[model samples]
Target: MQRIIVIAASAGSLDPLKQIVSALPVPCSASVFIVLHVGPNQAVLPALLGVLTDLAVVHAEDDTPIEQGHVYVAPPGWHMRLETGRIRLDQGPKVNHVRPAADPLFISAAETYRERVVGIVLSGYGDDGTDGLLAIHESGGLALVQDLDEAKVPGMPYAALYGDHPDAFLTAEKIGERVAALCG
Candidate 1:
């Protein structure tokens, strides 16, 4: 079965995101989705991350077929969700007070993919991705987080620990390594 990896990040996350993306294997085994808090016009993340990895990195478009070895990023101002073997982009109400919040993507992936999902919460502010990581954990999916000591902003990771323990607390690079190994 193909695996789905959902990642959430906010403030002080760019370097970690770069490290994680750079560490993945060229032909990654799972389909990766990322939701980074950005404004409606700040849609250049795909290009930024694309330069770090061999995998195709593109903005999530509604109804795009899920493809392994690719990384789909939530477009600015859109919530990205997974449905079976496809991706859905929604411009619905803001979650966590952010349009392209991680909760919706993480929750939908947990609900749709169940045990085949891997939810990762990286360096960020506030608790946007916490509940979603809990959903993934309750659904029997692997829930992981960046080590608090390593996070530039520890709020998100700390909140995740408070709600439910993650499978591991690792550096961004280690997280990528584990993700590759699991998907492999």
Candidate 2:
């Protein structure tokens, strides 16, 4: 089965994400899903990420096909969930005070994909993605997190690293390289 990568981040995440995305090989075997905390009115993340990487990045829409080699970013103020090979955007209650929280996306993918999911936590101000990472780990999926020293804001990565379940601990660039190798 192809990989399903769900990444969650918040404050001070853009640069790390750019490196990670730019390093991922073109024609990857994973369909990447990203959640970033942005206000309801801000919608430029996908385009910004698009300019930094070779992958085709788009704001996820309801019922959209989750195709390999493409990057789908949750729209501001909505959560994106994986439903088999498709995506469903939900206006569900926010987690950790953020609508597009990583927990929902990570848990959805972990539940549906089981061992095929890769849950990643990056730079952020809080512990939003930690529970999601736990779900992936409990389901036998790989949980990867950035090293705290490498993160602009270390709270999210630190939370994941504070636990024993994360499969690997590395820098953002290294994580991207490792992901490319896994999905190649």
Candidate 3:
């Protein structure tokens, strides 16, 4: 099965993302892509996520082939896209007030993978992932939003749920379980 999972988060996300990634099943067979808001000059995110998860994590490279068992991170200041089973990096203008916006990645994945895609909108400020998650849902992909009660910053997920009801509204632990189920 071809699987593409996108994880979106923003403020107060590091710890929650770490927990969710760490709890994910080992030797995952899905191509996991992460879009996290970060300062342009911040340290590498893939390295940080790698230390927290057992999965092989690396920053996405333009034209790099997508492979299972690897976790790819959108490099700071760039939007990550999926095209013909490979990664495409874009230094385009910011969308939703974020450079490495979640919408672009989710939209790109929906276009490329359709029903094979799974979009997760986690804790965050603003509404970066709201439109993207809707796009995913419209494209026949599975959409998940973090439960507001469990979110550190509930704006993103709340916006997503209100904008379009996701297929799953889950807590962090349940989200991990659902992701692992998707990989399975």
Candidate 4:
């Protein structure tokens, strides 16, 4: 089955995000999605992240068909969700006071892909991604968190660890390696 990876990050996440994306092999078989809390008008992230990875990286757009080897970054001000084989963007009420909060993306991926989903929570403030990671876990999807020691900001990872242990707690690089292995 084709795998789907949904990642969430906030403060101090750029480096890890870069590492994770850079680690994926060229022509990866899984579709990747990301949500990073930033200003509504902030739109340069996709290009920044695209520089380090061979995968096609683009700002997610509504109705874009899901494609393997592509990295879809949630555009600022819109919540990105996976629906069947396409992308869905919405301006729905923000969760955790963030438009592109990780919770909605993770939950949506979990609901849509079930065991085929992998939810990853990286360095970030607040507990925005915890419940969604739990949803992924409960849905038989893999849930991973950056190790507290390695996380630049521990709130998000800590919440996932304390609320319900994820499948793995790893460094950002290791997380990327594991994701690649899973999709391999």
Candidate 5:
């Protein structure tokens, strides 16, 4: 069980990510933060996803307080970080050639929340979240990866499995169920 959940995905990941979010059970006490690959002008994601999930979905803003049962999507061009119950967005240099890399977000959340964090890596083209998931593991947090066969782009999950070796491999819906179970 964890108080914070961070999800990272890219390249053919939108559908799975959306499913994961929409399937998340209620009484969800943990706050969800997402890092998805998008262009600088890609601002419609939060709204688009909001329609699919019961939880409030909004684009993340700098220095915004983190809340339970809400999903925060990292805005384009900024790296999002978790800071003691709040969020901080910065224009940091890109990692893995992506501006809003998952490593920074996962690492920051793990560093701040320690064992009270869960980091999940989903479908994506390249290896972006491996280091971050490793950081989460080192911090005693839960690390999960989507099943390689199920992912639209298996590269990211495979990398996480081989490079970081997460605690579980699951489908998006199963992952959501697991998250809900953690609250029990």
Candidate 6:
């Protein structure tokens, strides 16, 4: 089974992102990590996201063990990295103009998990997830991007599809189905 991570929307994203996450199948075998661009000063995101999904949703904690069936959100203003089955929280420099950028998370997962990883790029602005998705593809892991027409802001998905050919280009609903399949 593969570990699946989702790098979703930032501005104008709360509703769609929540809908997608909430639609994930229960008792999933993949550990779902999310990088949703947000301001550094915002309050608790895990609590907010938890309200939308039945899965255990929480902010990434330093050295926390990554487990299946849990959803981890990168804390505001920090980059989240995966290391030997554990989460490594870093105050790393922002990439693509966003702290906790999707690039680092996707890159780290590709490096650590290799072919046992699945990367998904959802709706958002800028090319944050493009480089990381490329890394995932290079590592022989599956890469998915939300279809441009289905994205609220298609820049991120468009950049990903053009920058690196993903394995799947799908809508949020289809993304959920594919993720569940990958986890099976």
Residue 10 shift from truth in candidate 5, angstroms: 0.5
Q: Write the per-residue lDDT of candidate 1 for residues 1-184, one digit (tens) a residue.
A: 8889999999988988888788778677799999998888898899999998888999989998999999999999899989989999989999888989999999999999999999999998889889999999999999999999999999999999998888889999899888878666
Rank by lDDT (best first): 4, 1, 2, 5, 3, 6
Residue 50's lDDT in candidate 2? 93
What Cα-based lDDT does every candidate model obtain? Answer: 0.91, 0.88, 0.87, 0.91, 0.88, 0.82
What candidate 4 gets wrong by more than 4 Å, as runs, is none
Candidate 1 global lDDT: 0.91
Clashes of each: 0, 0, 0, 0, 0, 0
**TM-score, model 3 to reference:** 0.95
Q: Which stretches of candidate 6 lie over 4 Å from their true place?
A: none
Flag the better candidate by TM-score, 1 or 6.
1
Lowest summed lDDT across 10 adjacent residues in model 1 is found at 20-29
TM-score: model 4 vs. ground truth: 0.97
TM-score per prediction, in order, is 0.97, 0.96, 0.95, 0.97, 0.95, 0.92
Expressed as tens digits, the lDDT of each residue in 34-141 for candidate 4 is 999996988998899888977889999999899999999999999998889999999999998899988988988999999999999999999989989999999999
Q: Candidate 2 clash total? A: 0
* Cα lDDT tens digits for candidate 5, 41-98: 7888888888887788998999888988898999998899999978999997888999
In model 6, residue pairs whose N, Cα or C atoms come closer than 3 Å (at least 3 residues apart or on different chains), thus clashing, are none
Model 6 — which ten-residue stretch has the worst lDDT? Answer: 4-13
Judged by lDDT, which candidate is best? 4
Evaluated at residue 170, the lDDT of candidate 4 is 95
